[model samples]
Target: MSYRRKHTAQTFITNALALLFIFLFIYAGLSKLIGMSVFKDQLSQVPLTTQAAPFLAWAIPTVEVLVVVLLLWPSLRRWGFFSFLGLMLVFTGYLIYTLYFSPYTPCSCGGVISGLSWRSHILFNLFFIGLAVLAILLVPSKSLEKQQ
Candidate 1:
């Protein structure tokens, strides 16, 4: 393939991934905010987060919304991908810890995602993590675009 075609393909993939992340964050953030009481209760049930449940209940959705804002801005899209990857890694790591190490596992996820089993949630996060990595790789730097 030609340079132009390859660049176009990469751009398309990156944009698609951004859109997906935006949707995921928006949905999750809104879901948690809307059901604040339930979400907080769920978080409180998690032994590790029981003490910080209240603060995290608010902070998590706020960060998700912030990430959505980053993803929407063209200039900040690369940072958005990095942010998404970092969040996914943290979430997946927590899930792994809860699944294998912790004696108690509680689902604090919002929306339909709350229904997913722990193993399924890990897989879901892994899939998004992989996409986040691909988006980071495919997103062209502003300098590169300027030179082109």
Candidate 2:
């Protein structure tokens, strides 16, 4: 309950969440790059995405990596936080679209979450989305933290 201890805890949580997002984004982006053929094939199977497969194939991983870079710098870390938050929301939306509207939901080509069932995958996305939201809420703005 000491002020110092509380401050340490807050700092730890902030850094931990930043690291978490960094790891996830890097892993995902690498997975796509490493398994390009498989990822492209998976994207092709999704309804209404066949034509955009080429564009998305390059774009998703690129943005993920960009977010990782953003997270590494203190000055731009807030942008990283917001980027991941938006990405997670978009991901969840795609997952829902596949589950409810598409005829079939294809599995991810790589990453730990690839093994999860569709329902579990949804939960997984939601879990990370919640984490992102929590991190954003808990971490002080860079200027504010510096001034503290």
Candidate 3:
């Protein structure tokens, strides 16, 4: 295809990925915040996070919302993709640890995501992680856009 068509396609894919992450983060964050008690209890049950449950119970949702804000702004969208990728990697790593190393795996994931099995959750995170990587690659820097 032509340069313009390719650019348009890339822009569309990037925007779609951003919207998906925005929705995921906002919904999951709100769900956790709304069910703070349950979330904290779940976190506390995890051997690794028991001591930090109270702080992390609040921090996780706050960071999720912050990421949504970053993703919403054009200039900061790249950072948002990076942040999304980082968070996904961390979460997936923790999932792997819980699945293999930990005898008891307590999931503190909020909303519909909490319903997924440990293995399924890892796959879900991997899918989003792939999308985040794609978005980062497809999103043109401001300088590049200006040149184009």
TM-score winner among the candidates? 3
Compared with the true structure, model 2 gives a TM-score of 0.90
Whole-model alpha-carbon lDDT for candidate 1: 0.91
By TM-score, rank the candidates, best first: 3, 1, 2
State, as a TM-score between 0 and 1, how close model 3 is to the true structure.
0.94
Clashing pairs in 1: none
Better of 1 and 2 by TM-score: 1
Q: Candidate 3, residues 1-148: lDDT per residue as tens digits?
A: 9999999999899899999999999998999999999989987877777899999999999999999999999789999999989988988998898788876788778878989999999999999999999999999988899998
Assess each prediction's global lDDT (C-alpha) against the native.
Answer: 0.91, 0.85, 0.91
The lDDT, on a scale of 0 to 1, for candidate 3 is 0.91
lDDT of 1 by residue, 9-117 (tens): 9988998999999999999899999999988987787777789999999999999999999999989999999999999998899899878887778777887999999
Candidate 2: 10-residue stretch with minimal lDDT = 104-113
Candidate 1 off by > 4 Å: none
Give one digit per residue, the lDDT tens place, for model 2 in 75-106: 77778888999998998888888889988788
